[model samples]
Target: MAEPYYITTAIHYPNGKPHIGHAYETIAADVAARFQRMRGRKVRFQTGTDEHGLKMAQKARDLGITPRALADEMSSHFRVLFDRLNISYDRFFRTTEDEHHRASQAIWLAMEKSGDLYLDRYEGWYSVRDEAYYDESELTEGEGDEKLSPQGTPVEWTVEESWFFRLSKYQEPLLRFYRDNPEFVRPATRFNEVRSFVERGLRDLSVSRTSFDWGVRVPGTEDHVMYVWVDALTNYLTGLGYPDETEDFATFWPADVHLIGKDIVRFHAVYWPAFLMSAGLPLPKAIFGHGFLLNRGQKESKSLGNVTDPHELADRFGVDQLRYFLLREFTFGQDGSYSVEAIVNRSNSELANSFGNLAQRTLSLIFKNCDGVVPPISGHTDADTALFGHVDRVIFQEMPANYDTLAFAQALEAWIGAVYACNAYIDEQAPWALRKTDFERMQTVLATLYIVIAQLAVAVQPVMPETSAKLLDAMGLASELRDFEGIRSHWYPQLAESDFRLVKPKGLFPRIEMPAEADA
Candidate 1:
């Protein structure tokens, strides 16, 4: 059997229209899943919408519709946007689905059996807007020094009969888990944040709510419903066939990674694992808290009127270009700013000018000079082998860590470095100059370029799928790539043979013009 690798994105809340930030995170996860599969791992990638929560209920009320109806309607919108973005999610779980509700109840029952659950009359400051309870330290002064939620939303006090998870009991265990698996929390900074929060002392969390009727009902209690996070987090397990005896549950249990935003790292990296451990289930292997994408000078907040439609971006810049730019612009696990000018610069400089131009000139030169036929390798040269090593190092050694860390920008940079090397080799070797004086050495030059260009097409495929695919097709090679190891082995050697034809190359990324108002 193959090695199992499971991954998930935090189920998005469908309380509002999809934005570029949502597309950014999904695209990041898509790259990870694609890379892992290329490494020959059995990958399961799950993404979904959180359909039941106070926010969803309120939005539904505002729309004059039932929560269930609203969820059905809003979920379709999210699905459409994801489809347009070409996101490759394996399972799209909805918290309102029966499988999720059953699995959530099962988790509650298991925690109850383990004595990790308790009944209590909860009295505390709660933020229905945030769907979170807050401590004094977690809150800060709003206008006039009034207490606000951590997100800066105003809070209100409430008392109700609720079930609580004994998170306090497992604070030491969680710290020990962090100690045992330091790599479990990602990006170093996010790990430190979780460690700091746990060190400050764990507080028992309210697991159920009595005021809202739009959530999963607590077992044997009509008034109490599971908290949104508790209910939504269970969708991860439910999507894998939890609460039902099945092979998928056994095969993919305990997800390998949960790729989430920095805002929700606590719920995933800390509370989530404690919940699983208390239920006697294995914890996910890792939780990567990736940073946000800011637009202009601020985060892309709808309140600030800065939200950009993902479809518009895709329309303006090709999807593959946008994906490459987003992954290559920001280092993974850190906040990065996005602007039209910045994206245009990257496209023009990196994709269009560097990579696309390399392919265009190489093929054009071959078609014009070599009668559209690949040149045969004639003799040995140390420079030729050394250039091959540079490209080989990127595909074989550097890529794994970059993909493991989700730093696609670095990975793509490494690929671009190889492209730069190939172009420089062409300039230094002067293949055109050698053609008249040393035709044999010129063949060697063309053959060397062939081998590395073939590798580049395969190595960078996962990052820029459509672009890489088109480039490979233009090389008259079959548009299929093997797994990373197979590609590393070069299973099909005929791909770089001398008789291959140089098919016409098309523009992979076209330049975009910025609006004149922004130019000032």
Candidate 2:
């Protein structure tokens, strides 16, 4: 079997429509999945909806529909947006699925059998909007008679019969886990935050609720439902067929990473690992909590009237451009601000001017001048040799490391640096003018350019799949040439040497005009 690699995005909630923030997370996970697949790994990429929550129940009630109906309708919206965005998740699971209920109950029983779960009366400050409970010390007085959680969401005092997990019991072990495995949480800052929270001490987490009837029922209880986060987080294992002893479960039980937003880092980094430890299960290798996508530096919220739809964004700007701009515009772990103006600027300058222009110009030269056949160089100068070596070095060496670290912007920088070098090589050699004076040398230069463009096409496929396929096809290369091995010295040169036929290549990305109303 190929080496297994499993990655997942925090599933979207079914209470709301999918937004740009959801798309950002899915696209990031997709990029990682695609890169790993191209590198010959057996990859399982999971994304889905969290359907069981008080928010969903209330939203369904307000909408005059059943919660399951609401979940079906809203979850379909996420699927549609993901399909449009080309997120290649192997499974888009829903927490309401039968298998997921089993997985949740299995873990619950295991933890309970281990003496970590206890029946208790719970009273706490809860944020319905956040699906979280907060202590008085952690809350600030909001409007008159209201208190807000640390996240600024309004809280209500909630009391109920509950099942509590011994989260406090795991605090020391969690600290030791963090110390022994420093890289278990990413970007260092986020890891330290989680550590500090553990050091301040942990409270036994309420893991089931009697007040809500919208979630998975507690394993042996008739009146209580699993806490929404417990039900929600188990979807990860459900996607892998946990408790079933299936091959996917056996191979991918300990996921390589759990990709989540910063807002929920505590849930994934603190509560999740503790649950796994209690159940005698291996933990996920990493929990990467990435920053939010802001609109004009403000969080996109419905009340703010600024929640941008992913479909509309894709409709306005091409899918590939949106994908590239979102990933490249932000450093992967930091907050990123997006605007129509910034989108147009980056699209026009980088895609249209740099990559698109170079591809179209070079491929058009080959079709018009070289009889629709790929041309091989007659000779190699020291400078020519150096350029070829540089492209080779980037393709085989630097890019894999960049993708491994999730440094997509830095990866693009490396690929585009080689792109710029190819552009410079064209300007210096003047391949177009050389076609008339020394046809063979001109063919050589164009051939060199062809390899550079083809290599670039392969490198960027994770970010811009459709455009990259188009780029490769226009170069008269087969679709099979897309794997990382395609860039290896063994196969690429042989194919480049053999091919002389080419297709008329058009501009891959069209420049978008600035919208009349965009943020400054």
Candidate 3:
């Protein structure tokens, strides 16, 4: 049986329509899930909207709609975008679902039964935009002497009757867990930040709110709803049929990774684990706080008039091109910027001109000169052997190592390096030039290229699923032979010996044009 692997993207808050950042995070998570599946894991991937929150209530009021209506409408946009981007999520969890509400209540009751819950009068600064409470020490002064959250979102003094969780009581236990599991938080920097915050000290956390009734209602309480984070965080479990100890819950609980944005590291790394500890549930294996995606060195904002619609970008640049550029252009867990020119240039230069050209030319040669049949390898020269070794090192060792560490840019860099080696091999071998002078040698060269090209297609499936599928299908590769392990089998020799004939090849990555305004 394949080992089970569970991964999730932070369920996006749906106060507004989805943005490029939402698309970026989900796409990266999708890639990770796909990669794990490619490695023969039983992968369960989850992503969805966090629908019950003060932000949702406020947005609905501002738009003269009920929160449920707003959530339904806005959540569809995110679902549409993910569908368009080919996100292979096992579950699209919504907090408003009855099952999720039951899961949230059950977790709250578990913590309550554990003596970690108490009613209290709460007074603190809270950011509605962030849905987070902040200590005075963490607040900074903004214009007009206004207090702001650490993220620069405005905060207001809040006082209400609430139910508090004994977060402070678990501080030492959490520290011990961190000490034992050094890799619980990723990138080293985010882990240090989380440890620093915990070392500073923790206060009892407000887990229920009386001010808003738009969230999961606290058990047996008519007026107070469970705090948004409590409801929001339980979503990870809800998708797996949690609180019932179902087969899925037993198999896929304690997720392999929770892929979230950097801004929410504290909520995931600190509050979430503390909640689970109180509930006597196991913690997730890791929390990876990935960096933001900036638009041309500036964070996208409506006030800045530069909030790019991810749908428009995907439509304009092609889904695979956009997916390739996002992973290729940026290091995971570090902030990266993108522009129209950058996307277009990277796609055209690397995907279109380099790898795409290599595949097209090699297959076109086989289709036209070799009479549409996969040519036989009469023999291999030193150049062919060297090319094979380089590609093997990349596809087998370097790329997998980088991907395991979530170093996506590094993995793709190794992949492109292999692509360059193939291009160089083809140029030096001059398979086209040898078509007449040495037809047998030419056949060997084309066969070698064909084998390596199929290997490249299989290797790149996680990043560019559709594009890779197009190339592999065009080359008549079998579905079962598309995985990493399956690609390494003796199928290539069998394929060449078979009667499968090559059809005219079509280009996969066409050059993307920069818009006039983008050039300006």
lDDT of 2: 0.88
Measured on C-alpha atoms, candidate 3 has an lDDT of 0.93
Candidate closest to the true structure, highest TM-score: 3
Q: Which stretches of candidate 1 lie over 4 Å from their true place?
A: 479-481, 490-493, 496-500
Q: How far is 84's C-alpha from truth in model 3 (Å)?
A: 0.1
All predictions: root-mean-square deviation over Cα? 1.9, 1.5, 0.8
- Sorting all predicted structures by lDDT, with the top scorer first, yields 3, 2, 1
Worst 10 residues of 3 by lDDT: 399-408
lDDT of 3 at 118: 96
lDDT (tens digit, per residue) of candidate 3 on 33-77 = 998898989999999999987888989999999999999999999
**Distance from true position, residue 212, model 1, in Å?**
1.5
Per-candidate TM-scores read: 0.95, 0.97, 0.99
| Candidate 2 segments whose C-alpha is farther than 4 A from its true place | 490-500
What pairs collide in candidate 3?
none
Per-residue lDDT for 410-512 in model 2, tens only? 8888888888888888889898899789998898888788877888899899999999988887676676768778665555456656744676767899989
